[model samples]
Target: MMGPTHALSAGVAFLAVATPMSHYVHHLTPATAAVGTVVAAGAGILPDFDHRQATPARAFGPLSAALAWTIGKLAGGHRHGTHSIIGTGVFVALAAAATLNPWALAATLWLCMGLAVRALWKHPPNRPNGKLDYRDVAGLIHAAIAAYIAYQLVHSGLDMGVVPWAVAVGYLVHLIGDSMTEMGVNWLWPHPRRYRIASIDTGKTVEKRVVVPALYVGLAATVYLTYPKWGPVLLHTLQPTTG
Candidate 1:
């Protein structure tokens, strides 16, 4: 799937999961949910950093290039190494260690890895070269990461209760959205054979037809959901403030 589609799908997932999770956690503050959504969307994008030549690496200049080069050199280029399950696990561990919030870190890492694996196996066209798809392994790693994150979110010191669920839901949304595309996600990879829902040719059109509308609708819904009563609040906070 293209970057835009991935991003839109990720955003939709973020909102879909965050809203309900927030309510469940009793932290239904608009601000917390919104922040969670944004974070989830960003997590969706993190896996694509494997594409060294992509705009993101280019945009960051030497720093991005260096990072991409290192990843490529260490992992064997996009979709081959870093796009694998093992790679995702490594990343998740690193992220968790860095953040010192093992649960949140794990969740974000798992979500990204799962998405990556699904993308890799389902959309063979994305891979171009035929190779053993390790997406299933990646998905497992993602699951582990997500589980850890969930545990942390529930037990962590943060007063907020909804962030972890929102993040996980957002990630799930990303996976489901990818499945709708022509290059459907590898719902099952590293099995006897590869399975996919859409063909590469149709994937682009599917993205245009499905993801675009969904993004617009999601944005509208988010705005409506977050709208203030009595009067609109200017300069909305990323997270809702406690009175």
Candidate 2:
């Protein structure tokens, strides 16, 4: 699958997870949700570091390329090591260590902010010509919301334990994505055999053109169907509490 597909899939998976931050760290503002969504998406594809040419690896730049080389060497190449149970466990444990620690929340805050900043960078909060444009206004609004999210996460001193689980879920989503391919992933590593119920050729026209779209559409439909149950939760989480 392509980078966009993996990202969108992971984002959808994140939406399916709950965040304790809603009650402890921060309210479930759109900004916080957006940050969480991006984190989950990145984690979803993080296991692909073994494939240097893989979308996630390329997006991370040269440093990631080197890491991919090392991972590839250790795992005996892509879709072997990181695609297995051991890899998933390692990722989850590491992520939990980072996300569940009180002090580590600062790094997580910075990470989320960076993601939000990069997204709004193209919108430019100010124009060189001195005239304000929709982009500038939009950028300011985005920055403000993200800043608020970062503040809550940083000062609340709450253990954002849910974040790591959400990321792990995203990784599982990636495994599921790989499972639907002809070159099935060895999900249960050390056990051998790439297990898959159905196989679709990865990077082929069918996958990019047909399968990806279908998955997204299905995701959208699921969201729509489930919105009724989640809508009230969002309202309560985001709405200001009354004294």
Name the candidate that leads on TM-score.
2
**Stretch of 10 with least lDDT, candidate 2:** 118-127
Please give each candidate's TM-score: 0.53, 0.65
lDDT of prediction 2 = 0.63
Q: What lDDT tens digits, residue by residue, belong to model 1 across residues 1-243?
A: 665555556656656555455556455555455445555554555555666654323323344445667877776555444443454456545544534565555454344433433332333222222342453244345456545654555454444434345444444454454455454444333222223455444356876788567776886776666555212434554347879
Superposed by TM-score, candidate 2 places the C-alpha of residue 101 at a distance from the truth, in angstroms, of: 3.9
| Global CA lDDT computed for model 1 | 0.49
Which pairs in model 1 have colliding backbones?
13-170, 14-170, 31-239, 31-240, 85-138, 103-149, 122-186, 182-203
- Model 2 lDDT at residue 11: 70
Give the TM-score comparing model 2 with the true structure, all chains together. 0.65
Give the per-residue lDDT of model 2 (tens digit) for 64-138: 346668988888788998998899898788767876554565554444343323322333322343344564455
Separately for all candidates shown, the number of backbone clashes (residues 3 or more apart, or on different chains) is 8, 0
Cα miss at 110, model 1 (Å)?
Answer: 19
